[model samples]
Target: MVPQLYCDFLQPDTTARHTFTVKPTELAYINEHLHHLNHHISNLIELRSALLHRSNQLTSPTYIVPHEVLSHIFNQANQMEWRSPQQAIVLSAVSRQWRQVALGTSKLWERVICQGPLKLYRDSSLLIQHCASYASSLDIRLLEQGYKLGAADKTFDTTTTVLSSSDVKGKLKALELQRIPSPQWIHMLPSFLRLESLSIISGHHPSVDLSSLPLSHVYLNGSTFDSLILPPSVLVLHLDDYFLDYAVILLRKCPRLIEFSSETYILTRAQLPPNLSNPLALNSLEKLVWYPAQWFMELASATGLNIPVINNLELKDSEGLKPAPFALLCHQISASLESLTLTYFSANDDWSIADLRHLFTFPIPTLRKLSLTDWSHRLILNAICALTPDEGEDGYTDRCLPKLEYLSISSQDEIFGLEFDFDYRVLNLVKRRRIGEDSPFHLDFSFCSDDDADYEAQAAWQPELLHELKEFVANRPVTITIKGGEVELDQLSTARFDDGDCSS
Candidate 1:
């Protein structure tokens, strides 16, 4: 299909070394393969063009009626009331074609959820059946009562033996099960055939062997994965405290894994993974993420990942991090980091303004984009001033973040010189604290989010904030992202700040 494929046919194999160079059989075989591939390629191009044309034709807004129709559907889906989600499911049931379209579209059917015990279990089964063929990604969440059902059926659900028989279980490419009431339902999950990404939260554990699971990417949060075992096929893994043995098991069993993030635990105790005995390190690794851990620094020191330049390392719960070692790493990170994010953990009581200055002591000569959230903006500003090109300090006239251009901050106050002459730019900022505490503290962490459900009620979603944001959008191109609760922005050229108390 490619030039390389053609070239590969020309290359001599081991047989070519020992005998008469080119055999007619080899030539014929290669020719047949090439001819077959060419047919496939021609078909592929035609298919692609057809799909593009169809997509354009269908996506164009033809009528306001359709928009009005879809708006009510989405409104029902997004509603906070009890039957809202079920109502979303019911809307799809208006007709077989509608059901097919709604379930086949990955975004619409991605989240297969129902709260409490819906009388529509029969209808839910139909959705599961519909998704079996169409779903590329799946998120199955049960309401509290649904959780009870999962708990009641725990033993029956978490089994490979049962999953193989289930129709909806096989087509799950990326599967997420959230708020599972019981740990027993895991057995009923389908075995991994095409499954690549799997996330299980607050669910029951599986009892059977998962060696056949085709999982390549995994994320386990807020539940126990102590019983879950990933096959060596896993390439990327994410874990929360619910699963502790993930890191240790992967280190020992998963030789091909390249990316890993786990908040389970960072310790070198008796429970330390068997791989730690003489932990073999990965050489093929390119990216690593470790967030909000009590022993993050110690784990960093223990792993061989202290490579001179880590591609992009994030420090979440930065409040837990001590100043000295973090400063040391920041200096080293300057050598190779392309992007860095420092998210403040809620536990930080003594988080200081001085820590930012420490980064200035050593030039982050290679740093390009720096994001800081929840801390004092003045501290970061002071650091910029250090890199500031004063007449006597540097050979140039003005250079703050000489190589650094984009910055995202989430603090209450405004810090200046961000646009000071060096191609530097402010990307965005967001809120760090809850709304009940203070209004402007919401100005922090605008550049990012990971799901702020821990304090949704505390989030500032007031009509006023939305009104101001809408006004800003009217003036300039803007992106307003709300994840669970927190809101963030991209560029705030005209953001107004109210002077408010921001006590630690």
Candidate 2:
């Protein structure tokens, strides 16, 4: 129809030799019709484009997916650290259907990570407000600005504006503040009434008090506080590079704490309060992880601090393990400790085999599971010797950890080393333990090596050892597993012993 109307305007010029004169009013009339024709053509082109887009969307596989499934995918993507806020924004811009799903998924907006110059705090606050409107709970992270330029007055003002907002204070459930520059920011923490988990890393302040809030988990790393207080509602507490004296003070206040972990806590025994002489009891504590500092060893070994019923204990020391203190500490908790893991990364000469033997000599009758990681093969052998039953005048008797049923030994550098004696001893211990027990016994060994020569050396002896182990446990109530080096036993049958297992 448009082409036909345009052809009508050209009809008067069809004769080639005809001379014609047009009046200004007649020319104006022709110009008006041509302008209208161009406008209608543009409208028809836009309509065609719209229809094509809609057709593509209807046939696309992504558009066919249910909104609930897409929303869940968006939520999972939002959980990733790298994807986070950018991923959520990108998802909302992909298409109409995706934007609707992304906006409706509240979890995608729950985590708001704010990190930039002080000038952006207002923007971050606005983002928090917008997110709070859609999410009932918020996990906010205020990361360090990385530059201290012009941060003195502006830091406090901007941080307060962002953190003290009614939406932030009311909706925040988890808060992580990293390298907070000003002490005033610490004072604003108590205003977050709905906060349950808080992590403050790498800052120095005179004091910190969270007793007013109903916190269930708190993590403090590379931070110093003169006076620290925790509420009894705290269930998990982790302190790294903090003062041991302060940790002791905080532990005394948290009676309901179920899990406590301390790593590299500065030891200042002289600064300890006089009342610390009284036995500190954590009756409800279930798990204790201590990366032992010297003061931690002395405090636990010398003092009367008692954890009556700790079920899981993990002690990892990279320097070296002191035998006397470790033995005493184990004996103190031996009654109720059900699982024990010992990890050390010291040079072979720094610790002696006798030390390892002495540490395990204490009878932890209640301990059913034991794991030793990154220890020298010699030390592991001594540990096995200590746990093995000693020959008495009458018969095999006086075995340490009489109720032990599970043992796992993992070494990243060292293997059994050109020696068959360790293999025989391990087999002997397994056979003796499984003899009169109706319950199944589990033994796992993992030896990994970065050096090709070392791995090959380990490979040479691993097969024979695995074969002997399989034969001993064949058709018996015993489970033996081996991994790392050149071993690949995972598929051979939960029963095959010809080759070792590889787990990497």
Candidate 3:
């Protein structure tokens, strides 16, 4: 649409005019043309809006990424060490595409952990419902962080109702409760059909029965021996303070138990039934552990149960204890045992050091691994050195462990009352072990001292010994490791090797 003045003055034969008179007819014509241009501008704006919407859809990375790859990305993001469920919630809220991918992936919503108070049970229930249908197995943990154990005002009924409801029951596979006040309502813990592992960590005994659950692993951190009534389906049981009789009852009931561990209390020898004379055979038991080194002596004397096929044994204590009973224990189970660990928790007068040397009295041919933690001394080092083949006119006779392969000794205690060295005696043992052929033995030795120079001397032993041992065997199979800390060792014990220092 041309302006009226241009149309009138700029004809082919007409002269150009700079001024024109205003007329009502030309004014209406100009208004009509302006309305048409306004419509064209509006149409161009609508076209741009439509085209940008199409461009966003075409350029979005979500459209480029295949659904299979996006699902894996969501799973990887959720696989990080999640301290709380809020982390997963934050990932889902990143964008609409992220929320869709997170919801579609079942593994992302499989585990839900809620800490602090029963009030969060409702929140957890909602989360469980959201993930219930797709998740094949659900793991939930409700922790009462600040509540006092056995407090009268605390109630876990709300938590029980939410967990026991139909929405969250059959799908629960793992549940961990930390510091819940009263778990008496946990009798229904067995009703979760697919539940595999349950851990209740508190300071009070809730008198809850777990005998109906087919749980593979159960850890009752604070329950007493009398209150524990385990089911037959339990494959592993770890208790805090258990009695001799309760241990017996548990062994008799759970024949499928693979491992049993506890912090045992010392009880009387008379607790054993007078009519029972023979040792009960624990055919399926593989590992037995007792803390407070004296408990091993007390229980061995009290209950004469024989673990015919046990593989691993560990004992820890602080008080000075005799090794005779421990030797007898090794004699009973030495045929099938593979690993033994003896730990002393104190650094007093080295009274337990003498007892540690007596452990080699009973020969364990099948013993493969031995750990002596916080009990490292000159006497114990002699025991290990004694394993070197005694090259006489006849062959070696005092070979204590024929098949032994691994030995670990760590000394983290202060050296005020204890003293030892990282000198030639230990170095010679490795050289002698490699005299005939490649020996399969490996020693892990760590010492703590105040001298950094001592560490340099100690650390040099490994590479020096390795260089010499490889002279015979093309590839030396023996490994000797040495490290040092803040404890002091004068390294003067080599001169006393001829003093007949075997402390029997």
In terms of TM-score, how similar is model 2 to the real structure? 0.71
Compose the digit string of candidate 2's lDDT tens values, residues 1-504.
112222222234323453447677566766776776677777677767666656655654345866445444544343344445644433545767555544655665677777655455434555666677777788887776622423456545654676677877888999988887667777888788888999988867777678899999999899777777778899999988866667778888898889999887454332454566678778889998887634557566445777888989887764544666667788888889999988864445344556665666577778888888766666666666656655541113545566777788755544344552555666666655553355677777654443454232332334566576667667767665564333343333232233233443
Scored by CA lDDT, what does every candidate get? 0.48, 0.66, 0.57
**Stretches of model 3 off by over 4 angstroms after superposition:** 1-91, 95-101, 116-122, 144-158, 241-249, 264-280, 318-320, 345-358, 376-379, 385-398, 416-419, 450-474, 482-504
Native-vs-model 2 lDDT?
Answer: 0.66
Per-residue CA lDDT of model 1 for 76-111, tens digit only, reads 453334564555534544654444444445554455
Clash count for each candidate, listed in order shown: 22, 4, 6
Positional deviation of residue 418's Cα in model 3 after best superposition, in angstroms: 11
1 against 2, candidate with superior TM-score = 2
Q: Ranking under lDDT, best-scoring first? A: 2, 3, 1
CA displacement after TM-score superposition, residue 253 of candidate 1 (Å): 4.7
